[model samples]
Target: MTENPYLSVFTLTKYIKRKFEADPYLRNVFVKGELSNVKIHPSGHIYFTLKDDKSRIQSAMFRSAANSLKFKPEEGMNVLITGDVNVFESSGQYQLYVQSMQPDGVGALYLAFEQLKKALAKEGLFDERWKQRLPSLPRRIGVITAQSGAAIRDICSTIQRRYPLAEICLFPAIVQGPQAAPSIVKAISSAESYGSVDVLIIGRGGGSIEDLWAFNEEIVARAIFSCRIPIISAVGHETDTTIADFVADMRAPTPTAAAELAVPSREELFERILDRKRSIYRSFSHQIKHERKRLTTTQQSYPLQFPERLYRPFTEKMANLDDRLLRNKNDITANRKHNHERLDRMLSYYSPLQRIKEESRNMDLLVERMTRSIQSDMCKNQDNFNSIIRMLRALNPLDVMERGFSIVYKEGNVVNSVNSLKVGSTVQVRLPDGTVEADIKSIKMKDKEEDSNEQ
Candidate 1:
C-alpha cells in the first residue's frame, strides 16, 4: 500500500484547501494596498490585484462581501482589506479572500456611508416626492423587527400607551447578521399581504454598522418603496440613517418614536369628542330656550290675541300726539313772533338810518366849531405872515434906497475907506451908480478924524 501513489488533482486540491482553511493565521489577516485590475465576476464575485511599492498580490471577494460594500472599489484606490489569505491549490497560487474592506486611513465605514448618502441626496433620490406620508391614524401597525429585540417591545408598549384601541401586529424579522436584509424584505412583503395594516414600522435597537447594514440594503429599501401602506423606518439610534429610512414615508429616531407616529393619543381623541358633544348640546339647549321665549312672547303679544287691541293704544296715542303737536306748533309760532319783535327792537337800537341822523346832527355842531377854529387860525397865520413881510421889507437894501439912502463907489465898487484910492492913481467914482473909474487925488493918514467929522 503506497498510500495511493498517484493522487488525483481534485483530491490534492481539496487536501491543500483544507490545510489553508485550517491554519488560524492564514484565516484572518488585514492587507493594506492599492487596488488594480479590479473586475467583477459574472457570479457576483470580485477579482482584483492589490499592489504596494514593492509587491503585488491577487485577491478575491465573494458575492457576500461585495454585496455588503457601500462603495465600489476601483483601481488605484488605497484600501485596508480584512480577509483571509488562502492558496488555490489547483492554480498553484495564493490569493487574499476578502471579507470586509475600507479605504486606508479612513475612520470607519460610517463616514463612507455618509459620503455616499450626501452624494445620492444631491441627485434628489431622497427627495420629498419619493417619500411617503405616514397615516394619521393607523388601525393596525405592522412592525418588522427582531422577535426578541427591545425595539419590538418598546414599539408595542408605546403604541398601546398612546392608543390602546389600535391593533399592533408584529412581523418578526432578523434585525442583525447577514440574514437580516432578506428577513426584513420578507416581513415587509408579508405585512403588505395583510391588507388590514395601515402602516408599517421597521426598525431595531442601536448597533454598529455591520448590525445596522440590513436597513441600508437595497432590497429592503426597494421593498419599503414599493409598499402600498405607509412605512415608518426606525433604524439604530437617532443619528443612524439608512436607505430605507430616506425612502420611507416617515423616519423615527427610535422605536418609541415609530410607535408614536403610527397611532394617535386615545386620551386626546376622547377629549375632543367630549368637547364637541358638549358644544352641540349647549348649542341645542340655547336654541330651544330661544324658541320657547319666542313662543311665550307670541302668546302674550296684543297682535296675536285681539287684533283690535293692537290699535287701541295707537288710537289713544294718536289723540294725545295730536294735542301735543298742536301745542308745540302754537309754542313755536309764539316763540317765532316774540323773537321777531325782539329783533326789531334790537335793530332800532343800532339802525343805520338812526345812526345817519345822529351823525348828521353831530356833524352840524362840529362844522360850526371848526369854522370858528379856522377863523382864529387864519387871523394868527395872517398876522405872522404880515410881520414876516414887514421885517423882510425893513432888511431890503432897495427899501433903504427908497428911504433916500445914498452910496459912494470907486471903480464900480462901493468904497467905505479912503485907503481904496491910491495917491496920484486913476480912480472911478460914482454915487449909487453901476460902475465908476477914479483917480486917487491923495493918500491920507488922518482918515479917523475925517470919518468922525463926516459922521
Candidate 2:
C-alpha cells in the first residue's frame, strides 16, 4: 500500500469549520449571561464577552443590528441573546453573532413591563391624583375577571359573607393568552355602559408574572386608567406588582382583599341599623309623651256638656244679636242699592261696544293702507321684469345672428375682439343659417381715418 499524506493544521481547521457550519443545531441558539468586557468599534460593530460564574463566550453584533436594540447593552448587565454560531473565516474561530438581545434576568416580559411603567408614569397614568376614591358602600359593583377563575369565586363568596346587600355585576373575560388584553379592555368598556355601577373590581387568580401579563398590557392599563368608575386591581400573590395595580384607584393583594375593599362588613352594618332603630324609638317616645300631656291639659280645662247652665245667658245674648243683625241687614241692603246705581253710571260712561266699533274702523283704514302699498310694490316689480326681458332680448346672440351679424370662433373658442383675429388664422363664422370655416385674409384692427371722422 502507498503511504498516506497528512493534512496541514490550516487544512484541518478548515475541515472543522465546515463541520461546524454543517451542523443544523448551531444555526439558532439562545444564551444567558452577564456582559463582562464590551468594546464598540468606530464602524458600529459591538464586540463583547458574556460570562457567568464559571465560563464565558465571545459575542459580536454589527452596528446595523445594534441600532434596533431598545436598551443599551452595558457591562455587568445580564442578558439573553438569540443568534447563530459560526466560524470567523479570517481567524478560524467559532463565535456567536447576536441577531437580537434583551435583559436576561426576569425574562423579556418583566423588563418590558418596567420600561412601559416608566414611560406611562411620565404621562401621569400612574399618578395618585388621577385615581378616584372608592365609595365605602356602593349600591352596585362591577367585577371584571375570568368567570371560571378561583379569583371570581373567592371574591363572590367573600362579598356574600361580608355584605350581601351590594349588587355585583360580573363582566367575564379571558385572563390569560393573547386574547386576554383585548378581552379585558372590552369588559371594562362594557361595564361602563351599565351607568349605575359605583365601583369595579378588575383582577384574576394569583399566578406567575407570565400568567398575569394581561393586567400589565398597555391596552388594559389604559382602559383601567380611563374608567369613569373606581377600579380595584387585585392580581397574583401579595408580592406581585402589576401596571394595573399602580394605575387603579386601589390595589388589593388578593381577590378576597379586593372584595373586602369594595363592600362593607355585614356585622358593622347591622350594628348601625340597631343604633338607628334606637334613635327612632327615642324620637317617637318623646313625641308621644308631649301629645299625652297636651291631651290631659285640654280635658281638665274644658266642659263636656252644659244644657241648662248655658240657656239663660244664651237667651239674653240672642235678643241683642237679633236686633244688631236686623240693623246690619238694612245697612247692607242700602249700600248694595247705592253700589248698583254707581255701576250703572260707569257702564253708560264707558261703553265697550262703542270702543269695539271705533277699533274696527281703524283696522279697516290700516288694511286699506297695506293693500295700496302692496299694489304699488307689485306694479314696480312688473315694470322691472318687463325691462329685464327687453334687455335680454336685445343682447341675445341668436337675434344678432338673425340680423345678418356673425360670430368668429377659433379652435372651438369664440373670438370676442379684433386682436384675436390674426392674419392667415383659420376660424369658424357662426350665422343664423350655419357655420362657415374661413381664413383671415387681411388685418384691419382699427382705422384712424374712420375714428377721426366719427370724432
Candidate 3:
C-alpha cells in the first residue's frame, strides 16, 4: 500500500496559523467595520464577526483586551478594531484577535461618557428630585480635590473670606489621571464616615475634558449622589460639565463659587440682622404710640371724668320702685278697710236685732254666727296682704344677692358664659356687701358631652 501524500487537517491549520503570525501587515492591522453575531462568553472573551457591505471576518477579543474597552461592544455597531490576524486551529479558519476596540468616528472616552449618561439617566440618578439641598449655613465644609492644586486653594480662600467661622476640612484626592475616580470615591466615603461635614465641595480647576474626565466617572457620580452631606460640584471652568454635576446637590461654575455657595457672607448676614432689628423697633414704637393715645382718650372720657354719674340713673330707678311699692301697699290696705266698713253697714241694715226680739232664744245663735263671718273676712284680707309682700321681696335683686349669689360683669357687660371671658381678663363681682374688682386667672369651658350628661 502507498503512503498518503496529503497533509492532515490539523497540520494544515498549524501551518496557516504560523503564516498569519509571521506576516507583518497582519500582525498589527486596523480595521473598520460593522459588528455582527456578537456573543460574550462566560469566560469574559467576546466573539463577533466584523462585516462590511460585501465581506465579513470572524473576530475574537480575549478578556485582557476586552477589559480595556471604554464602551460595550454591541451588535450592528460600527467600530474601529486594532488587533492581529490569526488562525484558529480547531475551526481551521483565520480570525482577528482584537487588541482594542472603539466606536468609529468618536473618541472612546466621549462615547463612554454619552453611553453612561444615557444609562444613568434611565435609572433616575440624574433626576432633579434625587439632588440634595445645600445647607444655608455650614459650620464645617469638606473639600475633595488635589491638595496641591489651585482648586483647593481657591475653595479655602473663598470660604474664609466669606464666612470666617466656617471650618474647612480637606479630603486630598487625585483629581486627574487614571486613579482620579477611585480617589474621589474614597474621599467621599471618608467624608461620610466622618459624618460631620455640612457641605462637600468636589472639583478641580479649568482643564481639558481629558484632564477632567475623572469627575465624569460613574463611581464618583454615584458616590456624590449617595452622600448624606450636600455636595457642590465645581469641575473645570463654567463651560465644563460632568456627570457629577448632574448628580450633585448644586453645581458651581468654579471652585471659588462653590465655596461661596457653601457658607453665607458675614457682611450680608450682619445687614439682615440690622434690618430685622430696625423693623422690630419700628413696630414696637408704633404699638406704644397707639396704646398711649387710647389711654389718653379713655382717661378724658365722660364716664371716667364723672364716675358718680354712671350709677345715678340706677339709684333713681330704685327709689321710684320703692315709692310705687309703698303706694300699692297703702292703697290695698285702704281698699280692704273700706270693704270691711261696707260689710258692717250691710249687717246693721239687715236689722238682725229686730228679728232677735221676735225670737229671743235665736238671738244668741245669730250673734255667734255673725261674729264668725266677720272674723273669716278679716283673716282672708290679712292673708292676701302678706302674700303680696312676699311676692315683692322675691322679685327684688337685693334678695337674690342676699342668698350668697353675685352678678359677674366684664367690661360693664354681664358675663353669661365662660366662653365670653379668657384668662387674664379683668372683671367686677357685685356681691351683697359691695362690688369687688377681680381678674380671671383661668377659664375652662365645659365640654358638650359633660354639659349634656349633667343636664
Could you tell me every candidate's TM-score relative to the true structure?
A: 0.49, 0.47, 0.65
Q: Candidate 1, residue 5: CA error in Å?
A: 32
Q: After superposition, how far is residue 440 of candidate 2 from its true place, in Å?
A: 93
The top-ranked prediction according to lDDT is: 3
Cα lDDT tens digits, model 3, 242-308, are 9888889899999999988899999999998999999999999999999999999999999999999
Clashing residue pairs in candidate 1 are 132-249, 412-436, 426-438, 426-439, 427-437, 427-438, 427-439, 428-436, 428-437, 428-438
Ranking under TM-score, best-scoring first? 3, 1, 2
Pick out the ten consecutive residues of candidate 1 with the lowest summed lDDT: 427-436
- Clashing pairs for model 3 are none
Model 2: lDDT to the true structure:
0.89
Off by over 4 Å in 2: 1-26, 29-77, 85-102, 275-455
Candidate 3 overall Cα lDDT vs. reference? Answer: 0.91
Candidate 3 stretches with Cα past 4 Å from truth are 293-455
lDDT by residue (1-455, candidate 2, tens digit) is: 97778987788778888888898888888888999789988898899998889988888998888876645566798898888888876787788889999897656666778878988999999887898998988989899998887888999999999988888899999999889999999999999997899999999887888889888888899999989999999988789999999999999999999999999999988999999999999999999999999888766653524455647688989999999999999999999999999999999977999889999999999999999999999999999999999999999999988888998899999998889778899999898989999989998767889889999
Which TM-score value belongs to model 2? 0.47
**Alpha-carbon local distance difference test for all models:** 0.84, 0.89, 0.91
Q: How well is each residue in 150-257 modelled by candidate 1, as lDDT tens digits?
A: 898899899888898788888999988889889999998899897899888999999888888878766776687788888898998999878778878899999999
- Model 1 stretches astray by more than 4 angstroms: 1-33, 36-38, 45-71, 81-100, 115-125, 274-455
